[model samples]
Target: MDDGRAVISVLLADDENLIRAALRTMLDLEPDIDVVAEASTGDEALSKARAFTPDIAVLDLQMPVLDGVEVAERLREHLPNCGVVIVTSHGRPGYLKRALSVGARGFLPKTTSASTLADVIRKVAAGGRFVDPEIAAEAISAGDSPLTPREADVLEHAAEGASVEEIARRVSLTPGTTRNYLSSAVSKLGAANRYEACVIARRFGWI
Candidate 1:
């Protein structure tokens, strides 16, 4: 427990009540770690951070109000010492890359063991780093070549539920040109469909 002089305070943010409860339980078992506060959304995490002043934040990638990437950015700007650990079910390769880009120090799958979770928390608190093994291997294998800027712009507009015509209108491009860009992006990402392309593009920071 490090003699109680130093305890790693944590702020947990997840959309599900049960998941938050479970994480609290597991972290409580560690004498040197404490759950100082809980939030259900990115906004709540940011709002409560000043009061809690937790040493670490365990956040999910997706949540209402704001997303984890934005939360991590704000934390980096406002709480420089507070480490971020992405705990999510979306184990997509793009997500892992983007999370690291956004200043997250650790990545742990939602399916990771409780012991591993505890270890990651402690390690990050003590200025160590961690990343999910599978994600690490995949990120390495992929070698990080993002789509072109125009392709990223196309994908971002498309991901926002825009139709091809609407995407053209928004991006100030001809409909046929928009379609071509979308098609090229899909091929470059090796995505089976536009939806998959959006996901891949997002992870690669193209959008």
Candidate 2:
């Protein structure tokens, strides 16, 4: 706590140990910021956030079990007061767009400055929002995502190198239907194949 206000409690969630350690060290330097808990996976982050009820949850965009957007959605439902900050290397307009759409209060790239990171945390803790300038610019210029929901799902599964049969089984679609979805996604994304389509879509944060 500082200036007679409650200290901003934070939950740090990232898969990388070194990244978490570095963030903890940097955040601990701020007088009004306290990292109350840390998580190595999205599920663990959710559990810790629920248990600690931190003022801010700083999460990596990609994690095991659940991604940052999924965790953010769940957090908004279960702990609306807990602000979410997506800190990721992705930094694509689509990722930023999705995070904001899902009620995340902050979206920052991993390249963000330490001071800027702290400031964003303060802003979110005070009921404000922040988005990386580069991400915002890219998002505005990138316009809308081209893939439909079903196409996006197929592409997302394909990103894992899944066979068409495997994706069909997972999505409860016939193999031929799954192949059609992949073909549609590839054409929409202007890629030569499903693998390329998945790469492009993931890079744009569309999946």
Candidate 3:
């Protein structure tokens, strides 16, 4: 602890070993912070949080088995005292909103400086919220998109040149249903064809 403050224990979760090692090295330099556990996947993070009783759990939003958002939801059920931080390379505008929605008090990007990272950890540990500045700006700029889930799904499949039959099979819908979704997406984007629908969706970070 620094200045007689309580020592803040942290749990680090990321898929990359080198990144974990680097973060540990940097955070260990602080007197009031202690990294109590590390996890390479969402499942491992949830389990370790139970065992370690960390003050904060810093996690990547993208992971195998269970995504970090699901893990955060579960963690809140299991470890109510621990804080949550969502850090990821993908800084999509929707992702920022989703992270906070899942009970994470903070959202950080991979490009964040070491000092800023440490500061976020400290602030979250002290019961404050943190969000990347760029993400905050983009979230407000993009505002709210009117695209629906089915539209986004159809656009993704269309971008890969998936036939309506194939998209229907992949999404558990009928060919007619897939076609309807694609047609609606085309109208929404003011696109002339499936290819143009995909292009505009990508432009707005919808797929």
Top candidate (TM-score): 2
TM-score of each: 0.72, 0.77, 0.75
lDDT of 3 by residue, 21-129 (tens): 8988988988888999999988899999999999999898766555677788898888988899888876766667666776889898877877888889889888899
Better of 1 and 2 by lDDT: 2
Better of 1 and 2 by TM-score: 2
Residue pair clashes in candidate 1: none
Ranked candidates, highest lDDT first:
2, 1, 3
What's the residue-level lDDT of 173 in candidate 2? 75
State model 1's lDDT.
0.82
1-207 in candidate 1: lDDT tens per residue? 267547789999988899999999988988888899999988999988878889999997767656677799899999999999988775655667777887899997899988898899889988999999887887676666566445666687889999999988765578998899999988988999889998876665445
- Tens digits of per-residue lDDT, candidate 2, 134-190, equal 888887876778875557776788888888899887655789988898898899888
- Mark the 10 consecutive residues where model 2 has the least summed lDDT: 90-99
Instruction: Arrange candidates by TM-score, descending.
Output: 2, 3, 1
Clashes of each: 0, 0, 0
Model 2 Cα displacement at 60 (Å)? Answer: 0.3
